[model samples]
Every structure is written in C-alpha cells, then in structure tokens.
Target: AARIIVIQKRAAGKKWGKIMVQWHPLLTTSIPVEQPKGQGIKDLWEDIRLPGEGYYFREQRFGNPGQTSMKLTERVIIAFSNPDDVILDPFLGSGTTAVACKRLNRHYIGFEISPEYCKIAKARLLAEKTLWD
Candidate 1:
C-alpha cells in the first residue's frame, strides 16, 4: 500500500511514503494479511489529512518537521507486521513509530540524532505505556 501526503500549503508538492515488502523466497513466510472490514484503509490512501496549524496542531508542536499522522503510521504498521514482530525505525521523529508499535503489540527500535526529539519520543512512549497500565 502507498500513502500520499498532501500538504495544504501553496507550492508544496505532494509527499509520498510507501511500505516496501521484501522476503526471501522459500525462506520467508510473511505475507500481507487482510484488514478487518470497515477499517477505512485502502490500497491508495488520499483522505488522511496532514496536521495543520489549527485544531490539529498539537502533534506538530514537538518540533519534528517531518511528523506524520498516527493513523497513517498505525495503518502501515498493521499492514506490514504481525503482533510481537520486531520493527526498526531509523528516524524516530516524535516517536510516532514506537507509539504505533506499542499500540499494535509490536516491538520497535528507533534512532534519532537530535536530543530534543529523543526526549519527545521517550515521553510519548511513556505516555502510551501509562495508557495501557
């Protein structure tokens, strides 16, 4: 599946993110599974709105310029991985990937170069942990 992020700002081109599926033939058994009915996800997603500077600006305040919506991250995670699967995120901006992994019962390793974003990611993960406790 592919998600195209359309920003509302003028002159901003559409941003693209994709889930790349790879497996060694005869060695890997991973395959995409069917999502439950009425999950609102499609092969081509065009309806998920980007967080703007209005009511949805709460997520953008973390100073991660490349922040994405949690819904999008969750959908991608669900499509690509199974419960308890280990996922690796090279850029852990704001901890969206980790939070989604926690919510979906997956283990994740995330790396961020900026200390500020690292702090934000840890806080977000902690918040998610407390939610289930």
Candidate 2:
C-alpha cells in the first residue's frame, strides 16, 4: 500500500504561538514553529525541491507509484517559473505538471515512457483551456 505523511503546522516562539510551515519534500508532525527566513523559491536546495511538500491528496486515484502531489507541483512551478517560462517534466506521470503549466500559461515539454500516462497527458494537454479563454 502507498502512503504519505504530512506535518501541517508548528507553533512559533517560546512566548508566542504562530503556525508555520517550511516548504520541503516532506512535512512532519511537528508544531507552531519558527517562520521560514527566506523566499520559498530561494530556499530550494541546489535548485531542486523534493515532492510531497504539502498534502498528498489521499483521494487521487490516477498516478504512477512515484507521482508527486499536484498541489506540490503547482506550488513549485509557480514559485520557480513564470508565465512564459518553458517547464520541462521528464516523468510526465498523469500530466499534472503539464496541466499546471498550461493553467499558469507556461510552456512545457515532457517525456514519458509509459504509453498509458502519455495518452493521459496528451488528452489532458489537448483538453486544457487557457485562463483568458
């Protein structure tokens, strides 16, 4: 069985309590913690951020074994890229990343070895409607 764990919030300083979250590959079950010190994208390590930085969408039924959360992909893409930027996804599982890029008006190039996922991604991309449209 596949599973994911998330640490949703943390308490701030010793005297004050403020909920805080640090964007990363995994979220733990910690508490109101200290606020992150840097911009989210700037905090990316070696320009790479791990997946499952947020909720894992336990309800999702379509994905490969290692598929990342759509919410996480969207957040990462938006933080690290712009409307005109060309996003590249080598895995292209279920096409979440490509769809996110289209929704955000960013161009994308993806590659997927699996035919099923490729079909899904193609259909998703073809069915995508631009925000302005």
* Per-residue lDDT over 8-126 for candidate 2, one digit per residue giving the tens place of the 0 to 100 score: 32223243354434443343232212334743322333333333333345545466766765666676666556678898888888888898898878899998899999888888778
9-124, model 1: which lDDT tens digit per residue? 21223445733222111122344556678364344444444443333433445777777778767867887688999989999988999999999999999999999999999988
TM-score of 1: 0.64
**What local lDDT does model 1 show for residue 21?**
26
lDDT of the candidates, in the order given: 0.66, 0.62
Q: Worst ten-residue run, lDDT, model 2?
A: 2-11
Off by over 4 Å in 1: 1-31, 37-41, 51-60, 130-132
State every prediction's TM-score relative to the real structure.
Answer: 0.64, 0.57
In candidate 2, the residue pairs with backbone N, CA or C atoms under 3 Å apart (3 or more residues apart, or in different chains) clash, namely: 7-27, 7-28, 10-31, 10-32, 10-33, 11-31, 11-32, 11-33, 12-32
